[model samples]
Target chain A: SAVISQKPSRDICQRGTSLTIQCQVDSQVTMMFWYRQQPGQSLTLIATANQGSEATYESGFVIDKFPISRPNLTFSTLTVSNMSPEDSSIYLCSVGGSRYEQYFGPGTRLTVT
Target chain B: GQQVMQIPQYQHVQEGEDFTTYCNSSTTLSNIQWYKQRPGGHPVFLIQLVKSGEVKKQKRLTFQFGEAKKNSSLHITATQTTDVGTYFCAGEDTGGFKTIFGAGTRLFVKA
Candidate 1:
């Protein structure tokens, strides 16, 4: 199991601004991902953070809106660019387990107004 | 696109009562996993079912995978206040790493 931590537990951001969330894992992992969850909704995969390369984003999500950077196997950052009210949600960092089960971080709650 | 459908989006039960959540996938799955998320908390991995018709138990929690590998369920016997949370099931397609997550079922327990 991997221990993951995210920064800025909760933040209230103004619209049109941007916020960068950080994720750090205790152990090296092959797969790291970013997810979004609206209030009382299911999780939606945002992107896969690939170390030393561009992130693989899911459909409906783009790099211009959510740019991700993974410097190493255990660290990654996600930037929510040009935030809007619709961007208000919980951003989670996760690492894949040996059997594909995912371990999640505490998540960074962003409230864009 | 793959989808995992969950039933009874919300359930309210009294303490000591039983609770159950079910998930069905449109495609065959190689494995299914369950997770629990408390209010204002992140999702925590609970268990994973790999083989068809698999049944696993952890204390008061019981998980079952359908023979078709396209469905699963999680049942809690004598539910407690601690069981109050959202339960989500994720299904991974055969030979694919991409997982489809269910909408989740929120269990509310009254003490």
Candidate 2:
């Protein structure tokens, strides 16, 4: 099991403002992913942050909107650029554990007004 | 792209009643994982099924993987108030790093 933490647990941002969420894992992990959960909706994968190199984003998400930086094995950052009211959701960072199980952070709740 | 679909978007069950959620995939999966997210909480991993036709039990919860690896189910026997949450099934494809999650089934328990 891994202990994962996310900074700025809850925040309210105005439109057009960007919020960068940081994820720190207690131990080194090979795979890290960013997910978004809208109000009354399911989890949507934004991108997969690799230890090095570029992150792999999902089809509906783009790097220009959600840029991810994984500088090391135990840390990563996801920046929501030019945020809109639609971007208001809970952003979660998860690490793949043994046997394909994923341990998730407490998640950063963002409300854009 | 792989897609996973879950049935019964919402369920209302009385306390002590049983509840079940089904997950179907468009593609065969290497493994399927179950997660539970309480209201206003993040998702917590429950278990993962890797073998075909495998069934695992944890307390009152039972998870089953289909022989085709394209479907799975989670059944909770004698649910409690703590069982109220959204259940998600995530399927991982062979040789793929991405895991696709189902839309999830929200369980509402009335005590």
Candidate 3:
């Protein structure tokens, strides 16, 4: 089991502004992922943050919009750039756990107005 | 791109009733995992099923992986108010660590 935490548990931002969410894990992990959950919607994988390389984003996501930085094994940051009202959702950081299960952070709820 | 489909997006049941959510994947999965998320909360891992035709029991919750490894289900017996949340099923692709999540089934238990 891994202890994960995210900064800025909840934040309200104005349109066109960017917010960087940080994820810290208790131990070193090889695989880390970022997810987004819209209101009353399911979780969607935004990108996979690798320890020493560029992040692999999903189909609907682009690096210009959501830039990710993974400097080390236990830390990563996701920046939501040029935010809009549609970007209001819960952003989660998860680490791959034993037996293929992923442990999630408390989540950072973002509201773009 | 792999996709996992979950049925009955929303369920409402009285306390002590049984509830189940089904998940199906377009491609064969290496493993399946279940998660529960309360309102305004992040998802918490419940259990993982690796082998085909595997069934795991965690108290009142039972998780099953299909024989074909492309489907899974989570059944809760004698549901309670504590079970009011969204249940998600995630599948990992074969030979890869990427996981795809289902739309989730929101369970509403009336006490």
Candidate 4:
């Protein structure tokens, strides 16, 4: 099991402002992903943070809105740009292990005001 | 686009009773994973089923993968207060490009 940690467990920010969430894993992982989970809803994939290349985003998300940076295998960041009330959600960092199971960070709860 | 549908959005069960959640995917999956998220917590990996028609057990929990690899189920025997949480089923497409997460079934256990 990997120990995953995310910065700013919870935060409140003004609309139009951006918030960058950081995720650190205890060990190196091949797959790192960012997810957005709305209140009382399921997890939605934001993007796949590749180690050295551009993140692969999902259908409803784009790099402009959620810029991701994966500097190395054990660390990554997700920045929510130009946030709005609708963007308020819990952002989570996940790492996939050799078994294909995922380990998740505690998640950053962002509330756009 | 692929979609994974989960049923029983919410369930209320008495302690010591049984509970189950089902998931079906629009596309065939290479594997299915189960996760549990306690209230105000992150989802924790519970188990994964890779083979078709696979059944795996962990303590009081039983998980099943459909023979077609397009659906799955999780059953808990004698639910306890500790079992109260949202259970999610995630399916990985055959291409392994992405994973589709189900809507999740929130379990409420009354003591």
Candidate 3 regions exceeding 4 Å error are none
Task: List the global CA lDDT of all models.
Answer: 0.95, 0.95, 0.95, 0.96
Mind sharing the TM-score for model 3?
0.97
For this target, which candidate reaches the highest DockQ against the unseen true structure?
A: 3
Worst 10 residues of 3 chain B by lDDT: B92-101
Task: Write the residue-wise lDDT of candidate 2 on A1-113 in tens digits.
Answer: 99999999999999999999999999999989999999788889999998779999989999999999999999999999999999999999999897799999999999999
lDDT of 3 at B19: 100
Give candidate 4 misplaced runs (Cα > 4 Å): none
For residues A3-105, write the lDDT of model 4, one tens digit per residue: 9999989999999999999999999999999999999999999999999899999888999999999999999999999999999999999999887799999
Candidate 2 structure lDDT: 0.95
Per-residue error for B17 in candidate 3, Å, reads 0.9
- For model 1, the DockQ equals 0.83
Docking class of 1: high
Instruction: Quote the true-contact fraction of every model.
Output: 0.66, 0.83, 0.97, 0.83
Residue B59 miss distance in model 2 (angstroms): 0.9
